[model samples]
Target: MVIDLPFIWAALIAIAVLAYVLLDGFDLGVGILFLGYESGHQRDIAMNSVAPVWDGNETWLILGGGGLFAVFPLAYAVVMPALYAPIIAMLLALVFRGVAFEYRWRTERGRFLWDWSFALGSTVAAFAQGVALGALVQGIPVENRAYAGGWWDWLTPFSVLTGVALVVGYSLLGATWLVLKTEGKIQQQARDYAVRAGVAMLVLIGVVSLATPYLNPVYLERWFAWPTAIFSIIVPALVLGCAYLLFSGLNRGYDLQPFLASLGIFLLCYIGIGISFYPYMVPPSLTIWQAAAPDDSLAFLLVGALILLPLIIAYTGYAYWVFRGKVRPGEGYH
Candidate 1:
């Protein structure tokens, strides 16, 4: 009996990527929402809300990227050249955001510099991520087992739309997260932002969903064909259900439900993407097996991953549990 090492590694990498998106996503959202706060103190509260777990949340990103490079080098090679611009922008933005996260707290005189840095960095990182995603979804041209596309291949109208969509989506996540983690005027402001962002998110999601199927015949069949078409109905229905929860939670002033529902919407969208890209690590050209490393390497990596993944999860969970509470003015984990 042969173990499907490639499939296992793919699943692990997928899980890591999803964890990064769901966890780091909100902090990025919070940073993106920074400038919207009317007062500097409100910004402080927002930053404090995420300071405890933000750095930790980025661990999954490292794991995901490392797994891709080590376990699926071919996919990494193909994807990197296709997405160099956005990927580089994302990394630089994240670095700026991190530097701002620390430096903003140190000096009162030049703090505004860091404040704008944080906001712009987070926004750019989120946008770059979305553009990279859009570029990937639109498909990279491959020839002779190499990237055959131009340097500007990633920049397109559809990719720009996705970039905008992600910025709005991340803002919604930040707003709802603030609703869950802060109180007083900040919470109220966040609730308002959540409503506006939520509506925009839904509309953008609909537009993206509609446009995505037309990008590839495979996507059209994966989404709209009989048998699999059940997902077409089911995913949207679930999204509607989540939307109801989100709006109702806001209307009723419930704390956690709206945030959870927002997360649900993201999860459903990720699942939808997965359904469309199953069996393929890089769409239009490569399958998981073809992109994967040798079985010996995969097996060795799996042993270490099995040991490390649980530890990371446990640490992340413990941090959140320890820090669970409302972030008031002038109080923070840092």
Candidate 2:
């Protein structure tokens, strides 16, 4: 049935989003943290840590988008048009980031320029994703399976808050990554940042959780349903415990714990959002079945995914394995 297809599509989309958050999230965090501290050596270490895997992380974002377009053309028709401007802005930010990483060391004067590019790009990209996500949550102006409102409709206050929240969340992920990958001073500072970021995330998520029901009563009823509430509480509690372990591990100078904790947090958060949306791909607007491609199209896409998805997964795994271990200085990301 079409219902099964949406669930399948939703699962795929969630994986892509999770992949982006995990892979690109750390690099973006490092970029923001780079601005806070004045240590060139630390910056090099941070950049080196993500260089090998950052590009691959972005692949999933593309895959997610492409797959959505391919498998759910109806969904794309509505969401993409509604989100035209922000999506364009997000792409520009990503382009800036890709180029900046390459040109960062082209010349001495290029240092500040590239640094700003990387930092600003990361900040903007994170914000753009959050805004798009927020707008989806807040409901789109869709009528008869088409986007109704103009471009600026995404610029709501709730969307802005989601943008800021995602930045803070990425910073937490970056700090935890540093805690796992670095040693001595950088690791220690990263630990401090992780703790701070974790605390802030808790507060922000709390506020968001409280506000969501008020923002949309439908979401409130969906989330507040008895069995669903239990699962939601359990998963997030586990995430909180993971955060505690990260702090404890950092306190004890446990190298691997921080990154593991970050991963757990991201996973839990992804799951929570998945639950929040339930049947809707674009909330308050289109249910996933309402937004799917035809059965024949999904079948064709499935054939391609059978080949392509595994290749992507295998290559991604291999790349991480090759880049395993700590990053070293004087080694350009190239």
Candidate 3:
């Protein structure tokens, strides 16, 4: 059987990106939450909760980017130019945050500086990602397989709104993660943050959902069409259900359920996005098949991906399992 190599690669990249968002997202959320706490010990506990697995979680992002470059070079070419500024900013923020993770422990006098760097880095990175998503969803100007828009084309009110929304979303994820990973005062603080962030997230989701159709008509048509419309209801239904679970779980002092429920909300949001733009990779302009590289190149890449992807997943799972436990005071990356 002649396999559809392009489709397979597309699916693989999608999954990789989803994994990156969910895994790295919570850590980023934790970083954002650092700004809220005054206690150094409480912050230490939060840092330790994510310290072991955070770097490993970022590997999925690398996989997603590499897969895109290899399998859909055309899309990469167009997208990179369109989002050059935000992408560069995101990378720099990630570098700062990574360095903060190590340096915060080394210098007692500079710890405050490093802590701010970590929190600000995480916020900037998350916002840049959201801006990129907003720009893509609103449709970049593409002509002759190239970006036709100016550098500032990505700066818009909708993009800004999405950026703030993502900050709230990631903060929620981080708060839930703390709920699962820490105990005592830090855990209670995280539970409080989770409820606040979760409510803000729901409001942003509604705003984005309402604004999406107005920003682009295609999303409206795809979402409300007859047979598909009925299916689409499942997305919102699951979101509401998960939101309820998150709140109830936190209120009931269930450590793991809130985190799991927050993840469900993230997954449902991703699925809704996929449903809105299934065949299109560039939104209203480029189809997946149109952006795909040559079949022979994809076939070559697929062989390497098949060998490497499973191993990466196994290692990631193992790391999480090894680090499974509650973080306490005076315990961290030292």
Candidate 4:
């Protein structure tokens, strides 16, 4: 029996990407919510809720990217070129947002500018990520391990809608995080935002669900095909269940349930996408086996990945544990 090393690497990289999205995603969401908070104090409290762990949360992104480059160099080569614009934009936005995180408290004179920078940076980064996802799902032009698409191929209406959807989705996650991590009127305000954002997120999910099949017939086939289809429905059903639980928990004034539920929704959505594009890493183009690096190289990478992944997980868990509790105004990573 042959062990599929490439498949294992693919799954590992997928896990890393999902971890980044679910973890850093909320912090980014928190950054976006900074725009909604009019008071500097409110923003400060919100920022502090995530500040201790935001940088660590981003490590998964680096892991995911690095793993992809190492394990599936061909996919990296094709995808990087296809998504050059949005990827660069997202990187720049993240850089500015990280800068804002440090500088916002350094000088009163430029604080306002820094605050706007954080909010704009978060918004653009999230939108760019969604656009990139949309472009991938809608299909990138790849031929002979290269991107054959025009520069503007990624800028379509569906991709734009996905971008807006991600903004609202991230904001919802941010609001729930605030609800879980803060107290006082800010908590109440976050709850209100969560409810509204939840509604918007649901609508976007419906639109995306409908549009996905129209944009890609392969999705339609996978979604409605036999036993696989029956299993596939479970993902969306779980998402809806999470949404229901989130709303119920919010109404009951439960602090952590709503955030957990929001995370569950994101997890389910990620799984659904994975189901839609299981074999294909470059979406309708390159399959994992086709694009994977040599098995010998994968084996070498796997040994190092095994050693580092656990340490990263341990550190991340410890950081969250150390900072666990409701955040109060003026008590944070400043």
Candidate 5:
């Protein structure tokens, strides 16, 4: 069956966003867990847990951006222009984290610098992305698909809230990941953080879910309407179940279960967002209908995805298989 261009972009962006979340999710999570470590040794362990596959996972981000640029060139034109400054900042942070990853273990003097840089870079990048997301959600000053605003235009209460939320979200992901990767003191610290972060995240999601709907009546009507209310109950129920498993797994020393549970929470949140903005890729400024590529573009890209997606899945699975094990002392980060 053939679909419209808007549907194609919607589907592709959803895939891109999911790839970014899962691929970079655990790495950003590592930085979050870095703060939970007692020493550089534990830090190294946490870092190494993700090092083997983290960079490979980044191909999805590149692909996501590239796919968007290709399929929804219009969105690229609109969003990048409105978001030039923050996007640049986000790229810079990504650069610093990449640099710090390589430089951290060369010497003692450089150790502290690189360690702080990694954490700072990760934190800033997460916050910046969140702000950009929030700005997009809250809408930018645009006329004729071009930004018509000053430097401070993107700075708003909603955008600031998004920055904080993304930090918390990343920290939650990191804590869960540590629970999966390490053991003993590091494991316990990670477990503790996961439980706390889980609870905090649960509350934050609830508040945001409620508030975001009110942010736009279009959203409000969609969420609060009849029958769709069924999903409302189901989504929260699933999230709560995951939260329950997270704490239960943490308390029982169940190792990887907490991580799996946290992932469930993140995935559920992803679903909620997808549902909330079903037809709108660029809220208040553009609809997915307005921003999609042509039919020929979708067909070409979709064909490539069918071939490449499976290979990506296989490689990611194998890499995880190869790297699976408790990180040992003196093993060091690559």
Candidate 6:
């Protein structure tokens, strides 16, 4: 059988990106919520909650980015130049955040600086990611197989809204994470934050959803067309169901359920995006096969990815297992 290498690579890359968003996302969320915690001890506990696995969570990001460069060179060429600013900002923010993780522990006098560094870095990175997503979804102009838009074409109102929406969404994830990982006053505060962020996230989801179909006629047809229009009903229904579980879990003081439900909502949103961009790698311009590298390279990489991906999963799972349980005052992973 002839292997559909491009499709397989696309799926792998997509999974890798999702794993990065869900994994690194919460830690970044924790960082986003860092400033709101007035008590230094509470902040310490929050940082401890993620420190053991936070850095490791970025492996999937590396895999996703490298896979894109290798497997879809054409898409990469067009996308990178178009999104150079936001992508550069995201990378710099991530670097600054990583430095703060280590340096904050080393100096008492300078800790405040590091704390702000962490929070700002997380916020900027999340915002930039959302902006890039918005820009992509709205469509990148391509002419003669190259980016045709001006340098600042990415900075639209819709992209800014998406950026703000991501900040709110990540804050929700961070708050729910604290609910899962801490106890006592911190948990209570996290619950409060989660409630506010959750409501905001749902509203933004609705706003973005309403606005998305209007961005491209294809999206309009994919989402609101007769046969596929059932998704418009079904996806919202699923989101509402997940929102119910999230709020109910918080109300009932259940730890894990709220976090899981939050993840479910994100997963469903991701699926919605995939539905909109099924055949396109660079939407409205390039399809997966058209943008892919030679088949032989993809097949070779597939062998390596199949082996590497499982090991990464196993390692991540084991780390979480070993570190399972609540983070307490005066104790930490970092």
Worst 10 residues of 2 by lDDT: 1-10
lDDT of 2 at 194: 87
List ranges where model 2 is wrong by over 4 Å. 1-3, 332-334
Best by lDDT: 1
Q: Rate the local accuracy (lDDT) of all candidates.
A: 0.94, 0.81, 0.92, 0.91, 0.79, 0.93
Off by over 4 Å in 5: 148-150, 332-334
lDDT, candidate 4, equals 0.91
lDDT of 5 by residue, 40-69 (tens): 688888888777877877778887888888
Candidate 3 lDDT tens digits, 21-102? 9999999999999989875787888888999999999999999998999889989999999999889999999999999999
The TM-score values for the models, in the order shown, are 0.99, 0.94, 0.98, 0.98, 0.94, 0.99
Per residue, candidate 1 scores C-alpha lDDT tens digits across 1-334 of 9889999999999999999998988999999999989647889999999999999999999999999999999999999999999999999999999999899989889999999999999999999999999999999888888999999999999999999999999998999999999999999999999999999999999999999999999999999999999999999999999999999999999999999999999999999989999988999789999999999999999999999999999999999999998988768844
Residue 152: error of model 3 in Å?
Answer: 0.9
**lDDT tens string, model 2, 5-52?**
666767887787788788888888887776665547777788888888
Which tens-of-lDDT digit does each residue in 171-241 have in candidate 6? Answer: 88889999999999999999999999999999999999999999999999999899989999999999999
TM-score of 3: 0.98
Candidate 1: residue 147 Cα off by (Å) = 0.5
Which residue segments of model 4 deviate by more than 4 Å? none
lDDT of 3 at 244: 96
Candidate 2 local Cα displacement, residue 46, angstroms: 1.3
Residue pairs in clash, model 4? none
lDDT of 3 at 327: 84
Model 4: ten consecutive residues of lowest lDDT: 227-236
